[model samples]
Target: MLDLARERQGGVSDYRIAQLLGLKPNQISMYRHTAVKPSNPVAIRLAELCDLDPATVVAWVNIERATTPEDRLAWEIILKRLAPQKRLKQAA
Candidate 1:
């Protein structure tokens, strides 16, 4: 389970996970913390990176994919707020 992965990885930052999966950091955080689940493609990537079962990831992904755009946007805002300060250090 992703919750377990979050725990096992010593509270791995969602941004790092996003980087590994080539997604926006906010998207990773949304998948991790919010009720909105990840998409199948995202689940597959997460399973591959986290050494988790694809089925489990698929279930979560299905739920996340079903979320409304408005809900996802809310999660995006929440995830941004929850992000660490260091993540803003990029030389953009």
Candidate 2:
């Protein structure tokens, strides 16, 4: 999400992203560094900012945070279903 925002036209800083998300700059840094994951609402907001589907973003995050293999598999299936077929093939 941070990368997508930074790569946007004119770009956006971490501080600006934090403001946009109603979070602290350090919190944004934590997310950027993968030290923490954003909450569901925040994830949805990020998906909007990145012009991505909220379900796809949420499923991707759920996959990353899943503690059990079953949960991870479920999220993976959802993500695969949500993603384009061409991208799925390339991801393989």
Candidate 3:
């Protein structure tokens, strides 16, 4: 999700994205880097603003919350959701 955001960010500053999400500029880096999980509202806004698939964005947050690092199951689930999103972005 962070990768997706970065890819789409263009000339938009992290501060601008933070404003869009109603968060601190520093917090944007944390969320973008996945150092912390963003709240549900932020996640929803992120999907809406970036035209991401809601399920895929939420699934990223879910994967971030996994108790285990290197969780293959979580990776598979995320990959499954992302495939269509990737295709759609490419088509656009």
Candidate 4:
């Protein structure tokens, strides 16, 4: 999901994607982390916005929905830790 988000080149920030899809920014954030799936309507909107296949988007959402909360939290922590390193590399 982050891959797709990055591919957008900020075309789909959490707030903007949420607003366009009638979801909350937090929901978009969760989607990025695979913490939760969007609603069917929101999934369709996300596919359109991200230029992804709707079926692929739906599959991703379903996979996210199946993840345990603890795993999601752990993954988020790892991402947070790596984020600065990624930025540093980009800056270099």
Clash pairs (backbone) in predicted model 3? none
RMSD of 1: 13.9
The C-alpha lDDT values of all candidates are 0.63, 0.82, 0.73, 0.64
Q: Could you give candidate 1's per-residue lDDT for residues 1-92 as a string of tens digits?
A: 55555665678776667776788988766765787766678778778777765654565455355458776665555545534432564333
Tell me model 1's lDDT, rounded to 2 decimals. 0.63
Worst 10 residues of 4 by lDDT: 1-10
lDDT of 4 by residue, 1-92 (tens): 54464457465556765676787777767766765667767777767767766655655565455568776566566546656775786799
| Deviation (Å) of 59 in candidate 1 | 3.6
Candidate number of the best lDDT: 2
In angstroms, the error of model 2 at 14 is 0.3
> Which portions of model 1 miss their true places by more than 4 Å?
1-3, 6-11, 63-92
The local lDDT score (0 to 100) that residue 16 gets in candidate 1 is 67
How does each model score on TM-score? 0.50, 0.80, 0.60, 0.50
- Lowest summed lDDT over 10 consecutive residues: which window, candidate 3? 2-11
Clashes of each: 1, 0, 0, 0
Measured with C-alpha atoms, the lDDT of residue 34 in candidate 1 is 83
| Worst 10 contiguous positions by lDDT, candidate 2 | 1-10
Give the C-alpha miss distance for residue 28 in model 3, angstroms. Answer: 0.8
